[model samples]
Target chain A: MRLAEAWRVALDALRANRLRSMLTMLGVIIGVAAVVALVAIGTGTKQQIENQVEGLGSNLLLVVPGRIQAGSAPTSSPLTLDDIDAINRVVGDRSRVAVTIASGETVRAGSRTGFASMQGVLETTPTVFVRNLDRGSYLTRTDVSTGRRVAVLGAGLARTLFADRDPIGRQITIGGVRFRVIGVFEPLGQSLGVDRDGEVHVPVTAAQRLLGTERIDGIAIRAPDRDRIGDLSTAVVAALTDRHPDTDFSAVTQEQILGVLGDILGVLTGVLAAIAGISLLVGGVGVSNIMLVSVRERTKEIGLRKAVGARPRDIGLQFLLEAVLLTTTGGILGMLLGGGTALLVDRLSPVPAALTWWSMALAFGVSAAVGIIFGVVPAQRAGRLDPVVALRTE
Target chain B: MTAAIVADDVSRTYQLDGVSVPALRGVSLTVDPGDYVAIVGTSGSGKSTLMHLLGGLDRPTGGTLLIGGRDVSTLSPDEMAALRNTTIGFVFQSFHLLARTTAQDNVGLPLVYRGVGRRERRERAATMLERVGLAHRITHRPNQMSGGEQQRVAIARALVTGPSVLLADEPTGNLDSATGQSVLALLESLVDDGVAVVLVTHDRDVAARARRQIVMKDGLISETR
Candidate 1:
């Protein structure tokens, strides 16, 4: 049969049953669209998290006490000031390092009292810590070396402790011990699971004297040069292992953490995609059923074509083309709809959903495969029809 | 003399509810080229069955059935279709033109299978329409034409391939007397053109015009003249 005539026959069959065609297409549409939308959303959330983490200088590594992996973890370690000093001395000049100790403390100034993260940190913390501040001075090397109990309030902490007052130079009681307020930080949003703009800062020595623990809970570090971050990371690990060889403690890089995060997102995308792939299988079933029904409905037509010299392959081509056309059309529509939905969510909310070109290509290719797979049996049945019996059928 | 269509002891049987029903039993016949042959019988007397077997729509269960010197009963389904397309044309009792296709497209269907070019289809389908006296109904679908017009379109499609033989099952069975005679005149005209024609009919008047006639009864040939 001529290709044109085969298409004409296919189109005629599709047109003959409008409701069935539409219903059949629904399966493919929903299936492809779900795959596109869900994968985009999953990958988008992952991208957003990585962005937020990188904003805090992706080269920055966190050394929290104990071993902890996010989403699934055990409690952090009891890292202390001595450990921080040791790491700093070894990784000195190779990476920027900061030692920090944190305790929940209540600050009182003139009748206002507020809860804050009383972080006793070295002066170098602000340099390697990568913060954006809105107001007064950060701590100086003078403050840490001198153990001067001077404090820098995060933007939120400043708001709470001083309200509308000029907070710098004023003294506030932390755990009832008075300390001079040196500065207030800028409003930094969520980063690395920490609220940067909502904490209070003090000198590391003072925190130990006040908390009566010489131990620090965390240390933040940044490789001095990004190009050598991996080398620097290896060096830091060797140094830390050398310092406390048998303690079972380890050094982690932000890049490694990001890789772990990406893997998690990949699994999430795959799982959601498989769930959506259920719809494609359903769509394939729809194509099979529709083509089968078309064969039955066009029995005489099949007979007539058989009588007229249509090869079995020719008959098969007609049915296969119809299925391919139907599914391909559905795939196109689904891509447009799914991409548009993702765009809409990205624009209207913080969904961060974005459709990639490959996603659309994947949808189309899968839909075509589905059509061929589903179209085969019905096309073969139509091809194998007996002309005489079909013509004589009422 | 060599025959255009010859069946030698051809037998065809069908399985119905597990019982083998013989529809054609050792039926043998011959038709010379350019002869108008009519097959006449009562309903279920195997005349339609004979027409079907001769047309290559069904294979004979036993013996040899030849069209233009080829044993059609031995051909594969696809090969038989090729034979039917190139060697024979068909017109059915019901004017079985596709319901929604224009008369021209219906006529062009055979040409499509024949792999004729677009220009050739246009020229040949139009000429066939003119031959059948339905030139004006070329663009009209089957439902838009009268029974007589529809039959003419069917005849045009059958003849468009220019086969040596035309097998028509009850060519004018659904038409009125005037329309039936006009269709029969068209069939007779094919005989004049030296294209052998086989007509299956219950009407004696329809059968009478054939240059030769065969009668079938109970799956066997009862008479030939």
Candidate 2:
């Protein structure tokens, strides 16, 4: 028989038992939806992490003044500005690397008080960390050279202290000393558990003078290119170790951090996708079970068709087409549902989710395969039925 | 001329729990074109089994059966199905029209298995329905038609493929006498057109409508006239 006629007959039969067909389809719908949505969410989260890491600046390396031990507390020594200069000298060229130091302190403006992470940086801080001001001007060479107490409030800190008003040129008390807010930073949500929007930037000299400590907290170094980050990190470590006999410092490259994060996220997405795949298998089983029942129920109809000269392959093809139609229809509906669900979750929560074309296609392909794979047994039974006995079945 | 159907020493047996129960015991029969034959017997007399074997719906355990001069016993299952498709048509007593399908589509069903295209199938089905005097009810579903009309539709379906023979198993058993008479008249008209007709029934009146009759008892043909 022609495939089109077989499909038409199959569709008619399925329509005859509409409620049963729909109930059978529900399993596949839910399965595809869960798979699509879960996979989209996982992929979206991984993408978001990659973008955030990329935002931390090109070829970035962090130099911290502590020796991390496996089971013991990290032993720390003070990092000085001379160490930053020593690392720059060891790296050979000033344009090849740039550094910024950061510390935490409290700030007050009017009647409001908020805790702020204080960043002591040079004029190159903006370029090295890839930061830009949302308003006013950034720190200048003269401001850092003369130890001027000019500060740039992070987006969140600006919103907290100044509400909706602009904070440029306004004076805020930091570490019991007043500093002028020359700029306000654009919102940079969160990175590595630190709230980027809640930090304030000032010169290293002014910060040391005001906080009564010349000891630096940590230095962020930006290499000229990504390929040079490892070499630059080794140089910084060597320079610091030579200058400080105790060598209580660690230099971490961006590639190392990203590699570890990629491993963890890759495993996480795989586990989630596998869990969703199990549900699809369950749905396939549901299809097989329902198709078996449908074959049994339509035994007489099958006999009639056979008597009318339908070949065994025709009967089998008809049933197989029915199963595929059910699943593909369910797959389409599930894609819409999954896409809508991903959009809803993205809007309703902080967890990121996105629907990509490849995921949709993959889900659809898998559902079609599920239909054919599960349809075999029932279709074979129908194909192998004895026409005489089947006609006598009722 | 080659006979439309020839059954020689045909035998069919049922195996029930490793015990043999013979249904047709070496029964032989021949039917020619334009023949209107009725096989009549009570239940368990194996008339239905004989009809099934004659229609190529079942194979005989022993003996040779031929339809349209082709040896049915030697044909593969696929070839048997093809022979049924192009050479024979079957009408059941229940008027087994698919529920909710229009009469035209129902009549065209056998043609679908013949690989006829949709447009031509529809045209042929429409002409067949017209031939059965159901042109006005072409779009009506089986449930929407009367018992006699449904039987006419089944007849139209059987004739759609232009088969050489028509096999009816208790075709009138589900109809009233008047409807059964009309159905029988349709069968008679096909016989006049030189199509062989085989009717299987226990109803005496239904069997009497045929020009030739065979009576069966105890798995054997008792008489034929």
Candidate 3:
């Protein structure tokens, strides 16, 4: 049969049964919508996790001091200035690698007292890790070298110590030694589950003096060449081993963290996509049911067309196209709904929702395939009907 | 000359509920161009069976059947479909003007199978409808028209294909006397135009209108008068 005529015949038949056709298309629509929505939510949550991880800084690596086993004095071989100096020298291109060292100490400001993480670092430490300083100058390299009593306080520390008062330049006592307030770091919300802007910064020598311990317990490192993270880690580990043979330490790479995160996202996407696939099967079954009903309804028409010289293949194609067109149209609408939903989520939530272009194509392709697959039984039924008996049927 | 239609020693049987009820047995007949032949029979006389075989709607279980100079006794289903489309036109008793389709589109149907362009096919269908005095009803659906009008539309549809022969199986079976006579007159006129016409009917008056009449009984032509 000619293409236009076949299409006309199919459309006329569908129009003859309007309610049935719409009901049939509804299955496809719901299937498509479900697939899109499920995938979008799953992928959106994954993106949120990635951003939360990334907020810790792309290059920053954390190292915690190994504590002495059982009741023994806290590892005397703590991360020291010598170890920090060795790490800095090993990755000497300052543009690429940076380091921060910190220790825990009791700090007293006016009448308030708190156990604060007193970090000994350069001014650039705030910009690299914790960010957005609200008040004063950070402890610079010159301050570390000279053992100045100037301190840079965390937002939380400042709030606790001075309340609403200006505490910059005010003197705070640490371990019975008075230190002048220099700068305040802005509130960087939650790093590794702790509020970052809740700490304090002072010159390395001043921190050692105030604590009466020349020990550093924590160091955060940044490497220059991301691709050479393994080499950088090796260099740091070797340098640390050489300086303090008995001091056990460990080094980690952000690339490894990123990989673990990627694997999680990939698994999540796969699981969500599989769940969405169930809808396609349901949609296909729906098409088959609809097609079967259509065949039964149009029995006389099929016979008439056959009597008028319609080939079996022509009859089959018309029914197949109907199903394909219905499913594909549903897929397109579902994709639009999915995209809009993702955009809405992105707008409403702190997490980002991304709708990749491939996702649209994937959705559409699945829908078309669904139509073809599900429409087969009906097409075959229509094709196989004997015209003589069909015409005689009431 | 090759007969317009020929059935040599034809036979057909139906397997109904696992039992064979023979519809045709060792029947043979020929129709030539411009011959207005009518087959008369009561129910179960196999007149409908003979029509189906002659029109190539069903193949004979035995013997040769030729239509438009081609032996279609062993033709594929698709080949038979093509033969039916191009060589013969059927005028069913019920008018069979497809429900919900415009008269023009129904008439233009053969051209669609023949792959004619849309515009020209519609024009030809219009001309055919006009020939049947139904030019005004070109866009009317079958259900929207009267019995005679619907039969006229059916006639227009059959004539639009310009086939070698026109076969009418009880063409007047569903119409009133006036409508049936008009439809018969239309069929007789096609004979005037040199198109062979074979009509099947039980009506004696309808049979008498044809140039020749064949009486069928028990799956065979009992007499020709």
**Most accurate candidate by DockQ:** 2
Model 2, B13-79: lDDT tens digits are 9899999999999899999999999999999999999998988899998899988899887898888
Q: Please give, for residues A134-161, the per-residue lDDT of candidate 2 as tens digits.
A: 9898888799779999999999999999
**TM-scores of all candidate predictions against the true structure:** 0.91, 0.92, 0.86
Sort every candidate by DockQ, greatest first: 2, 1, 3
lDDT of 3 by residue, B87-135 (tens): 8888888877777789999999878877888899899999999999999
Which ten residues in a row are the worst by lDDT in model 1 chain A? A69-78
Interface RMSD of 1: 1.5
The 10-residue segment with the lowest total lDDT in model 2 chain A: A93-102
Predicted complex 2: CAPRI docking category? medium
CAPRI quality of model 3: medium
Off by over 4 Å in 2: A65-78, A92-103, A136-150, A164-180, A205-214, A244-251, A347-349
TM-score of chain B of 2: 0.98
